[model samples]
Target: MSATALATWTVVALLGVMTPGIDTVLVLRHTIVGGGRSGLAAVGGIAAGCLVWAVASLAGLAALLAASTLAYDIVRIAGAVYLVWLGLSAIWKTLPRHRTEGGGVDALDAPGVSARVALRAGFFTNLLNPKVGVFYISLLPQFLPVGPAATAWGIVLVAIHLGVTFLWYPALIALAARARGVLLRGRVRAWMERVTAVVLIGVGVRLATTP
Candidate 1:
């Protein structure tokens, strides 16, 4: 790809990463509950998920998912169910029984969103979302360079997307960490979880309903 095209693709990818979505919320949720380490683990998982999609796109697996309605529906339903479950679980943790047992601590304690769990949450959340694969298969082709080297260029473009995500999410984690004093408070954390949970559920429903 030309420098101009590369630059444009980079900008687009950065914007995509920066756009607030389930991925962003998951990172923030994990960070709020489990601190920077857990947040980073989530980020790592999300990055792995993206890498999987990139590889799938290059291998035409993503295209297969996009082309086959049955495959797409299966992944979409699974993603929706996962998001709803996460949301419901978050809400469950905010209940009276869970809170009275402890106060200041967040989900890291309630149901236990340990680093490993966060990592798995991040990975599966992205992996199950068929739209992600569709996005990759559709978007990557536009930026790929022509000829036999195109496959390699696709990887480079994906790397660029992942690079942008790494930069953005870490900054997000830092920003949340800075506000830890207020955010970590029991009431505040509970409310934040509730809101995030609602959002997750709503996104899940939207995903399920949308074509």
Candidate 2:
């Protein structure tokens, strides 16, 4: 691809990354609960998911989701169920019995789950969303250069998307980390988690119900 095309795609990808979505809420929730390491792990998983979609798109796999309604609905429903489960879990953690003595930072530790949970949440959240596969299959070809090198250039475009994602998400993690003291306070953490959970559930429902 030419420099201008690459730069244009970079800007488009950056815009998409900067737009708040499920990925944003997941990163924020993990950062508030498990700190920067957890948030970074989530970021890594999301990037991995994107890479998977990119590779699948290049292999003509993502087109299957776009072309087949059955495939699309199955993934959509699965993604919805996963999001609802995560939301319910978050709500469960905030219950009275689950609360630590004074609802301290220790209470917000996410109890039994490790940073890997966040990583998996990030990965599966991105992976099960049929829209992502469709997005790649539809948009990627537009920027792909003509000829045999097109496949190689497609990977480059995806790299640009991933690169933008890395920059944007880590900066968000850092910002959340700096506010850790206030965010991890008992009530604040609980409320933030609750809000995040609700948003996740809402988004999930919307995703499921949308045609």
Candidate 3:
């Protein structure tokens, strides 16, 4: 690909990475609950998802998936359900629970979720969203140089997207970490989780309803 094409693609991909969405929320929440390590774990999960979509897009698998109405509906429904489940779970965990024993510690402050779980959360969340694959299918083609090596150019573009993500995520982690003092506190954390839950559910509903 020409340098001009690459630079344009890089700018577009970087903008997508910086956009606020479920991915950003997941990173922020994990960081708030489990610190920088947990945040990076989630970032890794998202990167895995991006790489998978990138490969799938280059292989025409993403196009095939997008072309099939039944397949798209199946994946879309699954994604919607998963998002709703995540939102409901977050809200349920926020509700007051009685202690089985006297002097039980308050578990509201730190969510106590493990890094692996956070990693899985990030992976499945993005993997289920066919929108990512659809996006790659549409976006990568525009940057391909006219040649038999179209797939090669696709890979290059995917790499650019991943590179932009890598650059953006650490900054996101740092920002989330810097706000740890106020955001991770008991009542504040609870409220934040509540808001996140609502947003997740809303996004799911919108996805399910949109054509």
Regions more than 4 Å wrong, model 3: 98-106, 109-112
The residue-by-residue lDDT of candidate 1 on 126-211, one tens digit each, is: 99998889889888899887899999888889889999999999999999888876887757888888998999999999999996
Q: What would the per-residue lDDT of candidate 2 be over residues 91-210, giving only the tens digit for each residue?
A: 888877787677554475466245799889999999999888888999888889789999989978888899999999999999998998887776877888889899999989998999
Q: After superposition, how far is residue 52 of candidate 3 from its true place, in Å?
A: 1.1
Best by TM-score: 2
Model 2 misplaced regions, further than 4 Å: 101-106
Q: Estimate, for each residue in 73-145, the C-alpha lDDT of model 3 and write its tens digit.
A: 7788888898888888888777667222342333463443468977887888888898998999888888887
User: What residue pairs clash in candidate 1, if any at all?
Assistant: none
- Local distance difference test, candidate 1: 0.87
Positional deviation of 94 in candidate 2, in angstroms?
0.7
Give the candidate order by descending TM-score: 2, 1, 3
Q: How many clashing pairs in candidate 3?
A: 0
Clashing residue pairs found in predicted model 3 = none
How many clashing pairs per prediction, in order? 0, 0, 0
lDDT, candidate 3, residue 69?
A: 86
lDDT of candidate model 3 versus the reference: 0.82
Q: Return the number of clashes found in candidate 2.
A: 0
- Judge candidate 2 against the unseen true structure and give its global Cα lDDT, from 0 to 1: 0.87
